[model samples]
Target chain A: DQQVKQNSPSLSVQEGRISILNCDYTNSMFDYFLWYKKYPAEGPTFLISISSIKDKNEDGRFTVFLNKSAKHLSLHIVPSQPGDSAVYFCAAIEGGATNKLIFGTGTLLAVQP
Target chain B: DTAVSQTPKYLVTQMGNDKSIKCEQNLGHDTMYWYKQDSKKFLKIMFSYNNKELIINETVPNRFSPKSPDKAHLNLHINSLELGDSAVYFCASSQEPGYTDTQYFGPGTRLTVL
Candidate 1:
């Protein structure tokens, strides 16, 4: 049972354009969500996160919008750059002291220069 | 100055063999975890230890054992490996066991069973 799902296996966008990555979750108990960027042969790096209470969070060129009612969230990168090409994994923090993360299969984003 | 490091980045062994993977974190985090990414690219948590104590153990097989000798080091030993055991294993750490804590992951260890 995949609680978190990134239906899109891959995405392509042109440089300086908008890049949007979407993710959905089945479990409503998840209170926190995060996005991670991973390159080949490298581990995932934390990109940004948002709490269930907040609808949106922005950091520089990256923004995350959460729609609790829809049980969906998306990461938007304005003016995407070629270096932004990587596998993006959406994760949710299961409600518990352990803070166990449920990760999606990941979406590979390719930015064409 | 790597925050998280795992030894034996690649491991190849035959079925029914026993092997171990070592992980260390110098970030002074109090929690460590082991995750497996299968061929489907699904990342699943196998075990988590906090301050050298077992805290979370998912529905993993008994053949997989995790040992945390200290807060900074966590090791995994697999016995009677099977073809299904071939996957990439990642080691991660967090400052504390909280939902808000960000985890730092290692480069990952690819285990191949023949």
Candidate 2:
């Protein structure tokens, strides 16, 4: 049972264009969502996060939008750069003290310069 | 300095062999966790320790064990390794046990069971 799912295996976009990655979750208990970017042979690095109380959060070029009714969330990168090419994983944490994260299979994003 | 470090970045062994992976965090976080990523790139939590106390243990096999001597170190030991155990293992840390805390992950150790 995949609690978090990213249906797209890969995505490609031209440099300086908009890039969007989608994720869906089945668990309603999850209250916090985060996005991590990972390079080859490296661990995932935190990119952005959003709390259930908020519908959208933005930091610089990255933005995350959440729709509770749809049970979905998305990460948008504007003016994508070549360095933005990496595997993106969406993770969610159940509400309460135990913040254990459930991660998706990840989406590979490629930015062509 | 590395915030989270795991020794033996790569491990190759035969089936039924016993091996251990060591992890350490210099971030002074109170919580540590072990996660496994399979060939399909699915990351799943195996165990979590807070201040050297076991807090979460997922539905893993008995052959796998996690030990934490202190808050900054958490180790995973696998016995009677199986082919299915071949995957990338990541060690992570958080400031506290709550869900709001952000986790820092290590480079990961690739374990291949022959």
Candidate 3:
């Protein structure tokens, strides 16, 4: 059972444009959500995170919006650059547990120059 | 310097073989975790250790065992390797156990069982 799901397997966007990646979860117990960016042959690096208490969080060019009622979250990157091309994974964790992360299958994002 | 480091970046062995992957973290964090990414790119937690004590043990196979010699090191040993064990293993560390804080991940060690 995949608690977290990234419906889109791949996405493409033009440079200097906005890129949006979507993720959905079935588990209601998850209170913290995080987005990770991974390059080929490397580990997933933490990008941005949002707590259940807040509906949105932003870091530089990246912004994450969460809708608890719908159990959906979306990541937006403004003015997407070529360096933003990578696999993006959305992960969720149940609060007050061991902090075990449940990750999605990932969405490959390609920013065209 | 690498905050989280795992040895044997690539390991290939035949079935029924015994192998081990070592991990170390220098961030002085109280918690550490081991995650496995399968061929389908699904990442799952296999085990977690806090202050050298086992905290969370997932429903992993009995062939896999995790050893924490100290708070900064966690090693995974497989008694009998199988084809299903082929995946990229990652070691991560955090200041505490929970999603409130960010956890750092290593480069990952790719294990191949022939």
Candidate 4:
């Protein structure tokens, strides 16, 4: 069964606008979450991550917000650029003895210039 | 230099054939992992190795085997490949065997079983 889920398959936004992608998890044991961006024919690149204790984390134009009560998290890219277009995957880990990352189905984001 | 590299960008073979995929990392990481992205686009972990020792083994078939020659190299060999074996395989590495260490992924190898 899929513990992490991203219901949205695709999203489109104009350049310079804020783009938001959402993800949810059913397992409460996951203590860490991460987001990865992947381009066509290329491997996923690490974007940002957040711990279960922290509610929010920000790095430059990318920000991740977590809501433990809702069992959900989101990735926000402010002032989105055309280069930001790619498939975004949300991954979660239990973080103690297990390092295996459970990845979601992924969301395809398109930024129109 | 490429931090992680995988040989054979694409492989197409008939059913029941045997093949191997090689992966190498120059980042001096101590952990390596193999992940498969199937048709549904779900990336699932197949195996993980830390310092050339098997750590995490998923519910994969016996036809699939992972071998690590050293800390920097991990190879996946599949025998009696089936039609469902078609997928994109990715090799990744980390400095340690923990989630705190960010994993770096390779370009991925597309395997198609006919």
**TM-score for all models, in order of appearance:** 0.99, 0.99, 0.98, 0.99
Q: Write the per-residue lDDT of candidate 3 for residues A1-113, one digit (tens) a residue.
A: 99999999999999999999999999999999999999987788999999999999999999999999999999999989999999999999998857889999999999999
Model 4 achieves a DockQ score of 0.81
Candidate 1 colliding pairs: none
Which run of 10 residues does model 1 chain A get worst, by summed lDDT?
A93-102
DockQ of each: 0.89, 0.88, 0.79, 0.81
lDDT at position B36, candidate 1: 98
TM-score of chain A of each: 0.98, 0.99, 0.99, 0.98
Task: Give the per-residue lDDT digits (tens) of candidate 4, residues A1-113.
Answer: 99999999999999999999999999999999999999999988899999999999999999999999999999999999999999999999996865799999999999999
Q: Can you write out model 2's per-residue Cα lDDT over A35-108, one digit (the tens) per residue?
A: 99999988999999999999999999999999999999999999899999999999999988776899999999
Model 1 residue runs over 4 Å out of place are none
Candidate 3 per-residue C-alpha lDDT over B1-114 given as tens digits, one digit per residue, 9 for 90 to 100:
889999989999999999999999999998999999999999999999988999989999989999999989999999899999999999998888866778889889999999
Record all residue pairs in model 2 with backbone atoms less than 3 Å apart, i.e. clashing. A99-B99
Which pairs of residues clash in candidate 3, taking residues 3 or more apart in a chain or in different chains? none
Show model 4 residue runs off by greater than 4 Å: none
Candidate 1 chain B: minimum summed lDDT over ten consecutive residues — where?
B95-104
lDDT of 1 at A103: 98
True-vs-predicted CA distance for residue B86, candidate 1, Å = 0.3
Candidate 2: residue B4 lDDT (0-100)? 97
